[model samples]
Target: MAQDPPVSDLTDDQAALELQRLALVLSQANQAYHRDDSPSIDDASYDQLKRRNAQIEQRFPHLKRSDSPSDQVGAKPKEGFGKIRHRQPMLSLANAFEVQEVEDFVARLKKFLNLAPQSHMRMTAEPKIDGLSLSIRYEKGQLIHAVTRGDGETGEEVTANALTIADIPKTLSGAPDVLEVRGEVYMTHADFAALNATQEQAGQKPFSNPRNAAAGSLRQLDAQVTKARPLLFFAYAWGDLSEPLAPSQSEAVARLQALGFSTNPLFITCDTPEELVSHYGAVELARSDLGYDIDGMVYKVDDLALQARLGFRATTPRWAIAHKFPAELAWTELLGIDIQVGRTGALSPVARLNPVTVGGVVVSNATLHNEDYIAGRDSKGDSIRGGKDIRVGDWVQIYRAGDVIPKIADVDLSRRPVDSAPFDFAEKLKQEGIEGKRAPGDAVWRYCGDEPLADLAIEALKHFVSRQAFDIEGLGAKQIEQFYHRGWIRTPVDIFTLKSRFGPGQLQQLCNLDGWGEKSAQKLFDGIDAKRSIELHRLIFALGIRHVGEGAAKLLANRFVTWEALSEAMQSAAPGSAAAAALVEIEGVGEVMAQSVVEPFQDPERFAALQLLLAQLQVSPAPQIDSSTSPVAGKTVVFTGTLTQMTRAEAKARAETLGAKVSGSVSAKTDILVAGAGAGSKAKKATQLGIETLDEEGWIALIEGL
Candidate 1:
């Protein structure tokens, strides 16, 4: 296992590598769990990996893979089972490992709904069953079909196997014309133990866990084999309901129970985070006593209307979250430390440990963070781990939070080897032929060699055509690398001129190259030609500037509107100038990022290259915001002081949704200022500038109807 740096700590090249690694690793894990009914990693590790992957994608949205794990739900349905398309997609829940995260979840819900802190909001907390999710459809009060939650949108039709579960209702007295009941199919501990005993007596391989036993039995090809296995269902949610089940989630579960379907008895409603956390603790206490397996407690907004308003993200519902149990920890001997260099030339330290089982997965590698961490200090020289440095032969405690990789928690000084000495991190780097110097205020040691690395250039080219960038079809990473090595393409500018350079009757023509025919070469040319008229955001991101990812590029495009405007602004954004101020005033752009954006334009050589690149194609302006009914459309608004109606984030988001540009600072160009309680300098500046000023209530009233 490889240790990964925090998303915030990763460089652009490192983030790209991490995305690739996660895509492959998560794909394998999904196959093992959904297809084979034998998970390669525990649920905690899987959730952690998913969480990390999502964090990285959120940080570097441009580098997100086309086959990103964040977008996938489950593995494809296994063969031999009739395929069924789910009427509604069955999404997974975001996870919360700490009480603070649960609180944050509640806070986010209130913020999204623009509700007061003291407002009454109920949430239902129920056990997250550790088994396979199944959707059973009932049409006209009769059972129609039963489908597994395969890849969210489609599933395996296991109607015959599902009918054997006594907990599932075959007929309903007063059900809707179309009712799709979704729940978990699980096996009780007692039944699983008995089944395992039977399997041993019959010389068959016993199942690993109750959840695996249930999934394997439910997915069995032979209906008789499934009938003989003990499987139970608990209905907690619904899909494709012709009529609403109930106004609230708790009521909906009750409605399912009334329909003769088995439901969890401990499901309860709570009004606050305290109550929710209390219920989660109670559930954890009762986990061992419960007959079936449950990984954690799931919290969902009780009011169905609120849930609908909250809606969903790419893969998880914004109205719900799973409060997972704490990570498991184990002690293992620290074997050695290895330094791995990323494509960005950043050196990362990984800890090798004697294989030990934490939770259910074997862990041999952990992240040491950096040299400072090994010296028992943080970047600020603050003492950590009681100022006890880690040694090579010490017994270290490792914990698996989300299983992308385990992390070292603590060092066991008492069990440290007498012969072991403090690890020489600097000497190790020198020994590995790494002679890079760490920049001031930067933790990472980057390669500062005079010559440019081929890997960096190739990675930049790959990023230019990444899914969220130019997204050139047929011209992928492999093609880009091959062309780069052959000296056919050196930079992004060369890609646009490729067709003209090697279309036909030219020395070293693309059609004459191996793996390239007339049709294939023409297809590649067409793909390149299609990107001649590109979106402003895509073109900006395709430039591959540091700190300018998809989100940042979109922000830049939205602010400037057109490529010519941005180009002119960047060229004239001198130090302390209005243009420079405006550049930093854009929300999410800081001094460092602004400098990165301005550096290329400031250099004559780079600016000349950019000009040449722009000359080869047409750059479209940013997408128009449909703010026909917005009172603040095309206006620059600033919020200062204490907001009573909503948080600053909500206010900003609302303003943006209404087509208003929310700037961080007030300037001569400022159109309006929304002042709240304890209004500060920005409000004063707005008043001095003779700009429109509105109190919180006034601002709210202005946009209330819309």
Candidate 2:
């Protein structure tokens, strides 16, 4: 069997390739585990893959895939349950393992909010109970529906099942007009044991854990079955509230309790990092005795206003983090290493280990980091394992933490393979009939082989046809993959010329294919033709340059206006050149992004490809969206607080449509700051910075002429 090279041996190109493969595998596994209720892989292995994906993204943010699994919240809802779209997505929190990590979390939050390092930021630390996340919606003081946190965006409606749980109040006394109480639905250890015992007596399969018992019971198709199960709900947070609950996290929990919902008593407020850590230890010590399982403790910014300002990332919230207990470790035999090629032509090493149980899950593989790590060195090339290299057939320490990839901690020198030799990454690539060379000033090797280049081209083609880019209606990912494998669509330019090259009278009609009929084939060709006269922004985004998302593309399009202008601008924009600095001036387009845009255009092969693509279509000039007539045009505006006239999203969208640059922070450069009700620190900061501030009516009046 072919072995993966050690992570230490991986080139940047190889890591990117492996990340793409892992993204697909882990997404499928998540689907099976969360939606189908059938786990194809053990939790440890799944966590390992997710961890690897995250590591690669962090190292190569520019190459972060569009369909990145890291940005995904949860699996899609199963078919049996009715779907309910949440007004606000139930986001997951970032994790911290050590006290230092917890401290770092607080420090990072302080920096984001522009607070001094020593400034006390009040926070709440609560036991993160191991349970299913449930959201119960109440309207007009009566419970309307309840749902599972399926994929965060939309969830499976379990209103019937929820009504059976006595702990979930059916009617609230003084609740908001519209309230979506979100929290954990868990089974106590005593309840779980009794249920399992009853199941054993009844000849049914018993649940493996209390969490599984609670989830399985609550998700029962029959409401009566759910009623029979003892499940408890703890309301800790609110989702869609028509009116404000409280000003702080602690007060909100108290409000939920007063409104007739069970709240976790362990939830406590901490004014400092030391208090947070102390409360976390207290929760951990009392975990086993609490009658319920808790994997960690969660810390949230107490001030609701701060939480609003912090907002969210692509997936997790910025205002909160879960400080999990350290991962469990177990010794496993190092089977062998495998080399996985990535789309970007980097060769990555993966460690295959004999199956071992860690943290109640089976781990079959762990990350070896890189060549240095395999050679018993850390990322900085410092000796970590007494200079003893990790070899095949050696006993290795494996670790698995929540949502963290399993990693090899140390090697047992006593059990090292006698005949083992240092793995040569370059030699291995040659042995596999792949040609690649390490670049100057870079540790990772880049593949020079034709097959790897083809893989890169195939990825580009997929992005070119993606919804956010070219958006070829009839040609989806599956169809593109099939076409590429069969040598039909070799390049993105080939896509535009498909119908012309392979007309109806061709020797092999698309209709002759097993999956394609005459009508479908015609539709595919028509879809390809419809995209010939694409907008400048779409073409720029379709290029799939690193760090260049749709927003960045739009910014570039607005600045450059035409294909020629953009091409000239990129060609002239050398790193640290005034031309590059000009590109960065465009709101939201940073230096890293500007460099990615220019570097690809500078490559001869990529330049040739772009020329070919440009020749095959009509690229239009970027439209100026009524900029000349709008007062907000070319202005940097910040919207803060709550707007009763319109939502934060609606206001932002409107501002952008009127050619205004909507910024998240209040800086000295801000032309206008729109302050709504509850306007807090950002409003104060705007005043301190001497930036123009406007209320909702003032903003509306300014834009009324447009």
Model 1 Cα lDDT, one tens digit per residue, 1-706: 2455556877775576566657766898998999899888877677877888888899999998899998888999999999999988999888899999999889988989999977868999999888999999999999999999999989999999999999998899888899999999998877988998777533245787788899999999999999999899999999998999889999989999998999998899999999999999997766656777777899999999999999999889999999987666688898889886544566678999898765444568888888888999999999998898988999998886533478888888889888888888778878877667788888776667776667667888888888798888777777787789988898889999876776346534666666667677778788889999999989999888877877788778877889999999999999999999999977678899999999989999889999999998899998655687788988999988656556675577568867888888999888888876446577768878999988766788887767
- Those runs of model 1 whose alpha carbons end farther than 4 Å from true positions after fitting are 1-132, 136-143, 147-324, 330-346, 351-367, 390-395, 400-406, 419-425, 471-490, 493-532, 576-578, 585-588, 608-617, 624-629, 633-706
Question: What lDDT score is found at residue 460 in candidate 2?
Answer: 71
Give TM per candidate: 0.50, 0.48
RMSDs, each prediction?
A: 15.7, 16.5
lDDT for model 1: 0.84
Candidate 1 vs. true structure, TM-score? 0.50
Range of the 10 consecutive residues with the lowest summed lDDT in candidate 1 = 502-511
Number of the top-ranking candidate, with TM-score as the measure? 1
- Cα deviation of 150, candidate 2, in Å: 0.9
Tell me how far the alpha carbon of residue 699 in candidate 2 is from the true structure, in angstroms, after superposition: 55
